[model samples]
Target: MCGIVGILNRYEAQSSSLHTSLRCLHHRGPDDRGAWQDEYLQLGHTRLSILDLSPLGHQPMASEDGRYCISFNGEIYNYLELKQELTTLGHSFNGHSDTEVLLASFAQWSTACLDHLRGMFAFAIWDKETQNLFLGRDRFGEKPLYYWYDKEAFYFASELKALLPLLPTVPELDPVSIDLYFHYQYVPEPRTPLKGIHKLPAAHYLQISREDWKFTPQCYWSLENIPPVTGDPATLIRQELEKSIELVLRSDVPIGVALSGGIDSSAIAALAAPKYRDTLQTFSVGYPGRPAYDERNQAEALAKSLKLPFHDIELTTEALVDFFPSLVAAVDEPIADIAAYGHYSGMQLAASQGVKVMLSGVGGDELFWGYSWVARAARISELKDHYLQAPTWKAQGIRTLRKLAQHPLYQKLGQSKKVPIPIQSWFRPGIDLSQMTLSPPDRAVFYELSPDFVEALTYRPHLFTQSLWEHIPLDNPYCLFPLSPPTTLDIPNQISQTLFQTWLVSNCLSLGDRVSMACSIETRLPLLDKELAELVIGLRKNQPDHCLPAKAWLKSALKGILPNEVLDRPKRGFQPPVQEWMHAVVRENLETLTTGHLVELNILSKSFVQALRDEFSNKGRHTFMLYKAVVLEIWYRQIVLSSQSAVRI
Candidate 1:
């Protein structure tokens, strides 16, 4: 809901540089701006005025006893409850702002206060007495915090842009991070595209003492650590979801729902309608000519059924092309997902309607078994031990047959690919005997990076680079807290944890925050509430796989509350007309790619780039990859090369 930046220097705190960095974050918080500084530390805050809309709510707020000063971003939904508890402990506050409450709670509980928080947050508390700085990110990384540290100084900010200016020199590109980005479509947390800067992983905090200048990061929470809850999953899910929605609805500004026709959004709208009633509004977007990509009609129908105000935006091919550069800029990272455009445009429409905050159904798919890959993981888990124990020759023979079946000559001979006997199928699992089909992670390995590209760049790949294509053990789910998969969880739950922790946080939530904030709007995800996610994880433990269908538990929980039509509809993701858009964008920007910044950086080969365009034009099967390449090219020109050269595109 706001932007925060700070600098801890061994020499002196520079207020001028702090002001310049804050200017870059102005879009994140346009309501108010304030800065506080001492000899060694400088803290700056840009406020959006979500809760307490008064002068007393201003931050770099100091505690009552003046022992702690804090600059916080994001809402602490349970702040009222914390305040009440603190009051009994002899704490007093002048304002109703969550910032004041947060500072006081830290004063009372110190680092342990993080355990009591239940909402999304990324904040820094400065201790005057101890001269120690503590920085914390929310349990699920709903908010972002990045920091850069060296012997002489430490710099932290809510966004990467703010920290970029404070660095003494231009940051070098991290090759391993670039490789990870290409594989995952986003750089996972604890690592950013820049070499020295790092994101504070979710559910973790960092503390630095001025005395020794030692920095220590510790994990305060983990989904895997919670014990299973005893209850009917359907009932518990309903109760927790409603409670989370109520807390997420806490805001002083107008709020809306980004309702897609999918069950996730539909269910959210259903639950929220009775609470906000006439004041609630709904927004959806669709491709005008692409009916397959259109969901506005379905969204409109659902909104009409609920009698809520509905707004829809039409995205054209031309519009997507024009907005491509700006969209990449808004993301601040190269993300290949085309659906991000839909989110960006939808948020723009909502902002135009004067909505300052919007709730989205983002984590539903990750929490529940909504993806085909997740179900596939369950299938894989069942057969993993058997597959590994099988004879090596038998596995090789099966793999050979699969490749042979796909040969052009074999297909031309009018021979059908042999379906493996049912007895042999268990060894192959989801694999079709006729064609070589790799699992998602295996496919990632296959596409890791072409040796040709690596040689062309002349960059040595490290273990972090190699790990992108390798399988990681999921034993310690927290190993990849804001990044990878789990080890102890069941296969299906492991898949859920992997996707929710890594994909949801790095790709989905990052895009949501950037695009929404680009329009100066705040976006909330009720499904990602810490309590709701924990409850669902516990519920999944006792419930049979069949009992929990893809979001069926939610549908049953809201049985009569939501329309049957909305609840029964199949899952349709927010996909745009990417194939058409990518082809068109590539053709239009072909010239730029040949001479763009990526080529100058020696990261991309001209021949390879041309081949991608050629492949897109002739085969068009690698639309996603081609789009990712284009985005990276543009991003390099804007972010990397723009600083070193005078080029403008």
Candidate 2:
């Protein structure tokens, strides 16, 4: 895991700045740094040295003939296997690391080599012979890659912060993306909040030449559109999941697991515990006195069950407060998720203990429908459909039942609005619904009736109606059985994939990559393997809930390997009690930061900032949104606005 940057200029000029920009990413690769430049291409890289701890592994790695030089970031888990194939085909390796194997694999298979890779990666390979530069991102975007281009030149980097310095002018935010961020807390691809710069979507590649640059992002994977199949899903799931876990264990370095005590992480620990035994190390974190925020007990139980060495960090609000500014700076893009601090603090503790690589069960929920929002979304959509599709008498009966048992009916209906009027007002706009309750999307339909609109339609309730049908589709299973879920794509599947591809890339992965790299730690997510992701998407949709249970698949596969009790336990996400912590520790700093710089910039409203601060100080329920807004505001002042008036970092 490292950072890579490069510049391809239309007109020749000094690129010493590329060195400085790459240096900013020194936290990403404290072990080594390397740079190379020829006629048109200048590439820089920082190395964390996970695979080969030798100079040979140092990148800006060139082919033997010097025709191609590649500056790479990320691990290629299948490099050894690919190396064997290349060796038989007459290629000699100079090192044992995956880096050498990656260049050799490219030499042997070119872009087709990407098809055989089974890990997260982002790299820029320059071909002196073809005068072409190839930039690629991992299949699932576990690693981040961004680029900025104009007619004059093109610049690419491992993080947006590196590229920001090279720009000669201020980049404007895309209004559409700003709105998207407000709705989703992260902007979706291929859109960033900033105009001109874009996150290369997952499973995509781009090739640039002196003449013209072409981007071809092929979908190597997808989870939404799986073909129909028949089988005993439970057994199939068990076998396939085990195979996937077994494959990820092939690292050259000592492998460690991030045991959050959540079902997902616990399952990974359980599966690998038997083989690893004495060598296995498990880690978790909790606030010292805040048991509600701690998973140490659960983690200890799992460790005892597996007989693996367990390590836990008891964090204080004081420690978190000190870490906040540094953590914020590490995240080049502002994000609302405070859980990043927990992950950062956890990684710091783990790395300090001398663990090199750690595995996390990140994709477990996306694959297994673990989150409540996903299930709830399906239920509500189905209820709206049921309410709309019912006979007049049946609909009247439901309405009557609704009055007698509103709570149960609403729970069964799978939709909730504190006040139904807002639902009608937000969607129906100018229409009257005094005698009618329309499904959500129908409200949008009434206002904008385009002749061609099928492709744009989705089953989201917020866009259509506030009532049962506010966002539900008639064909949507969620609409039919609001309480009961559809076997088809429910909230769990769709939300997970959407968040994985978009929000995770734009926010979580981006933030994780930046913060972890900023501290010189190469964070790896074993559960996020692309083949595993595609496999989950390809599974039978009608599989019994046992096979596709909300995070239950992991436990079933681990079976006797992990303790049954730990496997059955609930998910404890990497959530630090930021609200409580901030009120206790950083309330003063929050005020100073927000009022002093953030408000002065006018990027965020002063009134909004103050309200958020007060609400957070008073222990209000909506403090999370306030935290998000203030953090973003501070980010705008520090990274965005500060760059405008001063010399670039």
Candidate 3:
């Protein structure tokens, strides 16, 4: 896990800014830094030295012939295996580093090497032989790649700070994306808050060269393409998870687990503690005064039971408010998760303790049926499908005849009359009389914006300023998500797929990467392992026996591994005291209305700001909505307004 930046063309003009930008990512990789320049391209790398601590692990690493140079940012879990395969094919390496193995695999197979990789990665490989540049992201988007393009010049970076300096001019804020920020708490892929800048969607890749300056992104993998798994789900899930954990634990530096009170983190800690050679340290974050919000007590208990060293940090409301500004800077993306500061503070604590790599249990919830609302959504979406279907002609006609026969007037006066055709059905609207008009199901059934999207609808229109509305008259946020599922998937499986695409990829996974990297800590999520996700999802999709309630599969699988109490306890996720935290934070930062860029730029109106501020001061209504606006305002000031030099932070 490191930071990588590369320019396809115009190397001299961006050289100074490039170095400054790379320096800004010193936190991401402070061990060593390298810069490689060619007439056509310039590549920079900041090394964290996870796999090999020797100089041989240095990057912007080139092939033996110097034909292919790579600036890679993530670990390929199967690099050892790939290295052996490449060596058998007559390729040899000087050092025991994954970087060497990756460059060799690319040299031997080109983009086909992606098929052999099984890990989180966002890398840039420049081929001097063809003057081509290729960029790819991991399947679950555990790693992020942001890029900006033109006909001749192309730039890519792991984070926005480094990529911002390479742009010719600053891009304007995208209103549509900002609206989505309010709706989903983060901008969904492939649009960032800025237009023309994009996040390469998960499971996709892009490549360009001097001949074809413009290249379209291509999707290389998807869960829908894989066949379902058979047999006992618990056994299959456990086997796949163990394989991933074993491979993920192969790291040179010390590793720890982000232990939480919840089942997901406990399960990871339970599995990893036994496999590691030394005792693993566990970290957790909590709210000092808020009992409902803090779960460190339980987390500490789990650590004691596992016999691992434990550490924790308490984020007071004051600390949350004080770090709000830097949190936006660290996040880079204007996500509105209240617990983001917790991820940031926890990493700082871990880094101070000399923990380099951390394992987290992020994807466990999405793979299993963990979210209550998602389960409800699957059932509601099915009900909506039935509601939207139009009545057939035969069914409507039979109903009309029955109504007439039951009427008092028909029974008294026309009971003896033959009444060949029912009056209501005398005339057919369609010439063929069997014409059926179908109404497509509303996408809103499957789409939502958190806590309660339906409740949000009651006052959402009032929150957007009139001037902002005029600029984006056709901004329908629902269009950002998939409306229909393939015929092959069931409702629950399809809902899980959409969450993976939207909530997990764009919000949860993206936020996780930003916070961890901010403190120079690498977080590895084993549950997103290709084989593990495939097997669990495939089992849930096809097997009837696996159709249990939220997290039943995971609970059953870890019954013996984890304490029965740990597996059976209700899931209490990491949540902060939102009403108190946001109300206090927004009240103190209320001047965002007067001194903020959103107001100065006419993106937000004075009236709307005053109304939101009033609510925050009095009843604290729309706390989430108000907090979302405040985060955006701070982001604009801290990031965009200060973007004259991207490395200012």
Candidate 4:
């Protein structure tokens, strides 16, 4: 809900340019600004007034004895409770702001304070007593923190834009990050477009001291390792989710929900409307003529049923064309999701209506098994293990029978004649006997038939210029599965872990934080509560959490809270008029790519640009690839090329 920056170096110079760098994140915090510094450390904050709207909430707040100074972003939803506990231990505060309470808790417990905290946060605490600086991010990465270090000093900020200005020099373009972006739509954690700039991984805290002048990050949480708790998962999910909603709703400003037709947002709206003291407003967006992508009707009906004020926006192709460049700028990172226009516009609508805080349901799919393809991928991994583990003649006979009788290639015979129930278990698991020779991760990528992902896999070979291709190591991004998914967990849970690390953090939550913060709207996701995630991970330990029907566990939690009309509705993405929007944006910007920074910098080949023009001109066969190219092109022009003479491959 705010922006925090730190300039901690071993320099004694004055005029740190701290204020100039903090102003770059003006949209993140428009309400108030503050700064505090000494010879070696400078801290700055821009406040959005989510809690304690009065001036009493001003930050870069320091302790009574002045041992520690804290500049923090995001809300500690459990701050009030922590304040009461701290009060009992003789700690007092002048204001009701969470920043004050967090500072007091750090004063009392020091680094151990992270154990008692429960919310999204990325903060820097400067300890004058020890001459050390500490950087901490939340368990689920709800808040973003980026930093870069040179031999002289360390710089950290809430956004990449803020940190980029203060760097010693423009860093080299990270070729590996670019290659991963084309495959996964966003670069994964610990890697950004620049080589030295890094994202502090979630559930991590780093400490750098003048004593050693070393910045070492220590991880505090992991989804891959957790003891399984034996219980009915449905009851636990409902209980924890309700508590999370209550916690996130503790804001002083007017609050609203990002309501959609789907069960995730609808469930939040249903549970939050009555609990909210005021009329809970809802916002949605859709394309005007595109009914397939529009959810206004269903969203409106839910808003009416809940007696909440409903506001909707209609995006024409022209508007999306105009929004493209701005989208690239607002989302400072190069994320290829065009659906960002919807989230950005929705928050703009909320901000226009005097709404400062909004709640979203982004982690529903990853928590419960919402993506059917991911579920099938889990089963396929299990099937691969079956093929490898059981190779006896009898087992091979059953496998061969399952392949012939249950595979889709042989499904025509089953339509007329009934297939046995046992054999049906093998149906539609995305199996490939001939192609199963590859490793588990590679095989999953090979069979993944999702729309953008299918083209995402093979585009790098044809798209990258020859020099750039050989210059960078284009390791096969087994993106369909995960980034080093753990083996101790079940296959389904491993898949969920993969999506959480790769897709959820890199794509869903990354865009969620950037786009929403761009509008200065504080969006809270109750579905992605940390406790709920740990519980679900435990449930998947002995049993397959996703092996049930798709999102069955989540639907069970929402059985009576939401109507069957929504509960039974199939899963949907934040879809837009993809083909129409693609044509509008790609055609308008084709010339830019042909003569643009990407080719001039020798990053992309001329042949690839011509192929892109050909695709958009005639039929637009590779639409996602074209969109990725445009995203990188505009992002390159604005973020990379515009930065002074960035080093290239």
TM-score of 4: 0.93
Candidate RMSDs in Å, in order, are 5.9, 8.3, 9.0, 3.3
Query: Candidate 3: which stretches are off by over 4 Å?
Result: 10-17, 277-279, 389-444, 455-459, 465-467, 471-475, 485-488, 544-547, 645-649
Q: Model 2 Cα displacement at 183 (Å)?
A: 3.3
Measured with C-alpha atoms, the lDDT of residue 308 in candidate 1 is 94
Model 1 misplaced stretches (Cα beyond 4 Å): 14-16, 389-487, 544-548, 617-622, 641-649
Candidate 1 structure quality by residue, lDDT tens digits, 85-139: 9999998889899999899889889999999998889999889788899999998
Error of 3 at 613 (Å): 1.3
Count the clashes in each prediction.
Answer: 3, 21, 0, 0
The model with the greater TM-score, 1 or 2, is: 1
440-499: candidate 3 lDDT, tens digit per residue: 344524555254444545556776667678756453666654454336676666677888
- Model 2: CA > 4 A from native: 13-15, 214-218, 224-230, 382-496, 542-549, 582-586, 589-601, 608-621, 641-649
Q: What would the TM-score be for candidate 3 when compared with the true structure?
A: 0.90
Which whole-number lDDT from 0 to 100 does residue 158 have in model 3? 85
lDDT (Cα, 0-100) at 240 in candidate 2: 65
Please write out the lDDT profile of model 4 over residues 212-304, one tens digit for every residue.
787778987787668887888789888888998989899888988898899899989998988783757999998877899899999999999
Q: Which has the higher lDDT value, candidate number 2 or candidate number 4?
A: 4
